[model samples]
Target: MRIALFFALILFHFSSISQSTDERAIREVLAQQVECWNEGDLECFMEGYWKSEQLVFIGSKGLTYGWQQTLDNYKKRYPDKSAMGILSFELIIVEPLSEDFWTVIGKWNLKLNSDNPNGHFSLIFRRLGDEWVIVSDHSS
Candidate 1:
């Protein structure tokens, strides 16, 4: 009976590890976003987002449609190094929406020489091709 129980525990542990592997992959994607932002690489940062025209990004100014529009907006709003100082994200929630989708809720903070701007953001990510990319983002 003890041996059977041990095997059951081992199986449970393996299942838990398997489940967490996906979460870890999602987190790695998130971490790459942070690293790219910190490095002041907007293009690299944009890699985390879906490249399709259907991708959406909502911000204080309003909603932006299309990946180019989103990139344009980012360039306009953070026009210089001073404005784009440093970007950091504090993940508040991360949950699997389905086998290939995830919902992420977090706070984004930017430190600038003039002022620090921070807001809450929620993003819907989907596993596309070989990586996870944001399909939709809403920030306030």
Candidate 2:
């Protein structure tokens, strides 16, 4: 019984360590997206998402499916550097749903030239190989 308990503890410890590492990596991806958006690099910001037609994005405009469509929408909404403005994100929660999935809840703000648009968003991310990519996003 003691031997079995010892192995169980070891497994739990290693599982926690792996989850912690994954959490950090996920945060890094979000941080990079923020940097990209602030720099008015729409293309770079899109890199955080999965580049597949299966991807889904929900915004005030409506539901947009596919990676290319989402990128196009962003480009249309924010045409130039002035329109992109400074991007900021207030992350409320980053919860791990499973070993391979995470749900991120956050607020995003963009200080545009004429108006400031701020809203809350929830993103579903999936671990693919060595990286985590946003598979679905709901923002309003």
lDDT of each: 0.87, 0.93
Q: Give lDDT: candidate 2, residue 89.
A: 91
Q: Residue by residue across 1-140, what tens digits does model 1's lDDT show?
A: 99999999999999678557767887888889888878877788898899999999988888888888999888997776566888889999988888788899999998888889899999998988768889999999
- The numbered model that scores best in lDDT is 2
lDDT of 2: 0.93
- Candidate 1 residue pairs in backbone clash: none
Task: Please give the lDDT score for candidate 1.
Answer: 0.87
What candidate 1 gets wrong by more than 4 Å, as runs, is: 1-15
The residue-level lDDT of candidate 2 at 8 comes to 100
Which sections of candidate 2 miss by over 4 Å? none
